[model samples]
Each structure stands twice: as structure tokens, then as C-alpha cells.
Target: MNQAPLPSYAPLAEVVRSGMREGVHYGAVVGLSAEGEVAYARGPVHDAMFPRSSAKPFQALAALRAGAPLEGTSLAIAAGSHGGEDFHAAETERILAAAGLTAEALRCPPAVPGGAAARKAFLAAGRSPERRYMNCSGKHAGMLAACVAQGWSTDDYLDPEHPLQVLVREATEDMCGERIAHTAVDGCGAPQLAVSLVGLARGIQGMRLSPEGSSERTIIEAMSAHPEYVSGTDRIDTELMTRMPGLVSKIGADGVLVLNVPTGETVAVKISDGDAEERARVLVGLTALRGLGVDVAPVKEHLTTPIQGGGRTVGEVRGL
Candidate 1:
């Protein structure tokens, strides 16, 4: 009853250059009303798509359900794609330590810090790429903590067939309110389940609107309360949650974004252009928010990316 049937791909944004259009970013977007019905939708809202990191909130809920004991910054980071700042790294280490584990237990591929400044400082300090610096390390660490809590094997935690991953699958399916159409390995090696944009919007809104003391409410509150840990300092998720009270927002890799307003309005968007940049995504998502009655002007100024021509700012990408 939440989803509205919608059509094929729609043009969500445009690359503008000197008053001329450069190209279009085609994608799907879905919005849910405060009452839980699909308010509006464009593109293929019914088709399966990967939510990527936007799925972290549910993953964190599964961790909690499995007895990870997450709260505050710990819960936020467990559901965040944190920029690898020093504070982010330190917290990740703390999570692993709580379970009597070390960074050596992380199976994610090693990577330098995700932030430009942090990566530069880390390399300057003679630190090599490390698994903890990977943005997904926090999620992996929380999973490990849950595994340890439940006596699940730690070595194959990333395996889809693992008991922890089974919890992940169940949590994801329960939130999205649909069976996963496909299961695939994500960039960080966790299982990625496919759901429609409508389902994503519905799920996020449902979680945000869930009653107090629920796992869903816990995830939303922790994320909103500790936005900096959910992402990192100055990041989009952090900035949005900081600037706007009572909004739960997260950006996913591969042009995915989900936003839930305190009023229960939620929007889920996927930028379909392989060439589309991250900046383009928030702009499109903000447009969806504006349509749902949120005043987006407070955050729209620098959220959209500007185009460069002859070393000067020439254009921008705006949602259609």
C-alpha cells in the first residue's frame, strides 16, 4: 500500500554549461507522504536497485538485534560511511577492541583515509593503507562485535551464508517490506540486496516514524544525535543532519541517497548516469525534498556541484 506504481527511467537532472545543456542525468526517485503512501514517483520505482550504503541503518539494527550493544557514536558509526578522519579511525579501533579483536580481523581491503586531508596527513605520518581506514570498517567492526556477542564465527562474517549476514538479510527484507530480487557482494564485501526506490523510501520513512524504543527508532535517533559519527566532520550526511533538525539522511555509493524529514516525508533517489558525480545526487534529492514540502534553500547553496570550463566555474547540475 505504500508504493505507487510508476513508469520507466526519467531525466532527473541536467548538466548546464554557459546557459546550454551539456547532458542529462537520468534516474529514479520516489517520495513517501507523512501518512506512508507514495506521494510521487518518477522513473522505475517498481524495479529492483541496489541501495548500497543507504542500507546501513538496517544493518546497524541487525547488529543491535544480535546484541552488539551499540549506542551514540558507536551506533552512528556502525550505520555510517565515515570519512577516514583520525577521530573516525579511533572510534573504529574502539569498536574492534570492545570485542577483543584487532584491525587484523577486518576482512575489508586496505585503503588510505577517505578524506583528502586525512589521507595526506596519514601518508605523511608514514602510515600505509589500512583496513580501518576503509569507510566501511565501522560497519564491519560492528558486525564483528555482534558475531562475538552471538558466538558466530568471525572469520567468514562477510559471507552471505554466515549467521550474521542471515540476520542482515532478514533485517533488510523486513525493512524494505519485500523479498530481495538479487543478492550481490558490495564494494566492501558485504551482501547488497536489491529493492525498488519506492520500497527504499517507504522503509526509511517507516523506520524514521517508528515508535520510541524500537530498533528502527534507535537507529534514527542515534544517527540524528551523532551525525558527525554517522559520517564525519563537514560531510553531507553530517552537514544535512546538523543544519536541519530531525532529518535522517545518508548517501550511498553509486549515486544512491535517502532522506527522511522529521515530518515523515522520505525520498529515495538513484542517479542513473554512470558519469554523474556525487554532487549531482544531493541536488536531485533536494529537489525531491522540496517537492515533498521541505524548504531546501537552507542547504541547497553549495550542495550542487559546479561545472568547470577554462578553469572557471561555468555551470551546474540541477534536478529536473
Candidate 2:
């Protein structure tokens, strides 16, 4: 196994147990000032990193710009990394139905639901995983709908040179205010763009600050208004959006998260040791919010990660 070279990343969070330092999470997490400058950077802010599902909002915006008739929860699902709950699946299905398509059209691989409870219930009911239950089906569905609406080829919609992808690239560059340095296949089979941590922060900020009727604003509003569709019941995105009204929040796979407040404060975090641990990423995001004077009093319980020991209480991981 190859470990990341030292010095490229600084300590962004720590994993402790029983008053001992068990591990350290090295990564880049940044807070963007209102002027679009990097005010605080824990690591290399401009290093090219995949935005993962964090790119969904802008991708959904691209689909909207292409004339996909997404609105309300439909729009939210399009931009969400849903927990694969029943309602999430229903909305995703609705998008495909409206596109004159069905689950067989989804190219993303089949998988169990992202939510633990949903997966348990699905398995208990003697069902197998399906594409519609995949966490990113909503994103893929939205892209298909856009291709159909624009008369573009839905089969090759994920292709980088496809018409829909061309618009997606344009939308990302336009909103992030930075040229995407590279493109790669996302876990869900969509094209993911590489941009700086600060770029991600600035991009999400645009969602909040863009004109009310613009595509960016529409997606942000939908994500905020229907937080449950954006993620699921009690998930981080849904919980945070509900607690912090007017916040546009999204979490991507492999320890990626972006938080944006209505007041224009924005944060983006990437765990340099990607997939090191899922428990610490949200804590880091909340800590970054504290840097911007956003008091997370309502979410005080989330500030620490509880370490379980044989089903008993143990130590926890807390943001530095």
C-alpha cells in the first residue's frame, strides 16, 4: 500500500480513543471569503481533486438549462446523493417516467440502498439490489431526461463529447469560475470534473448567491426546500438543511462535503486520505462553518463522533 507523501496535506482532523491519539486525518479544507479569496486553508487549496457527487448541483443545473422539466422535489433529487429510501426511489422513477424511460435505461451499476435502515428493510423483504436503488440513480435519471428533452443521445449521455456533457462542462466552468483541470468517470458512471477545494467552495456559493430565477438558484432552492429528497430522513444533508435554514448542503462519496450558507459564507472539505473514514468528514465541515461565525448550537451533538466499543460507549473523534 502507498501512503501519501508528507507535507502535501496538513492535519485537518484527529481520531482519538480513550484519551489517546489513535489516528490523524490529513486533508484540504477551505473557507472562501466573500471576495472569492481563500481566507483559510488547512492544506493545498488549489490542488486538482475530483468533486465527486459534489458536482451534482451544477450537473443538475446543466440538465435544467438543457430544458429538463425538473422542478421542486424532482429538481432536488436530480442534484442529490440520495440515501435510496423509498421516496427517493419514487422521485427518481418519476424523473425517468417523465423522460419516457425506465429503470433499464440507468447505466449506473446496481447496488443496495445507501441508508442502513432502507437496506435492511429491502433485504428483509427478499429483494435484490437494482439500479433505481443506487444512490446516484437520481443524477443519472436527470441526465437522461435532459438528453431526451434536448433530442440528444441518451445512450451516450455520459460520454464527454456528448451534447449534454458539453453543456455540463460549460455549466461547471461557468459556475465554479474556474476551468476544470481534468475530467474522469464518477463512481455512478457520470463524468466528474477536477477542481480546487476553493473552486468547489466558490461554486456552491454561486448556488446561494445567484439570481433567484437562475438555474443555480433553482437547484439550490430545491435542495434546500426539499432537503429530504436531497439526501434522506435524518441524513447529514437533510438534517443540516433543516437545522440551518437556507443552507445548501451536499455530501459526495469518499469523504467529500460542501456547505453553503445563505449569507454567502461557503466551505469545502476533501479528505486527502480519501475513504479513510466517513465519520470525520462532517465534523470537519461543521468546524469550517464555525470559522465563518455560524454558530452550530442546534447541532451540538454532531460536533463529536462517538467511538463504539463492543456496543458500549467509548471515546470519539472530534475536529481539531
For model 2, what is the error of residue 134's alpha carbon versus the real structure, in angstroms, after optimal superposition? 0.8
lDDT of 2 by residue, 109-207 (tens): 898888879988999999998999998999889999999998988778889999988899999898888999888899888888988888889888887
lDDT tens digits by residue: candidate 1, 1-320 = 57644336789888899999998888888888899888778888879988999999888988999999788898899999998998888898999999999999999889998766787889999988889989999999999999999999999999999999999889888988998888999999999988888888888888888899988988999899998888877578889888887888899988899999888999998887633357677877888888888887778774467889999999987777
Off by over 4 Å in 2: 1-7, 275-277
Number of the top candidate by lDDT?
1
**Root-mean-square deviation per candidate:** 3.6, 2.2
For each candidate, give its TM-score against the true structure.
0.95, 0.95
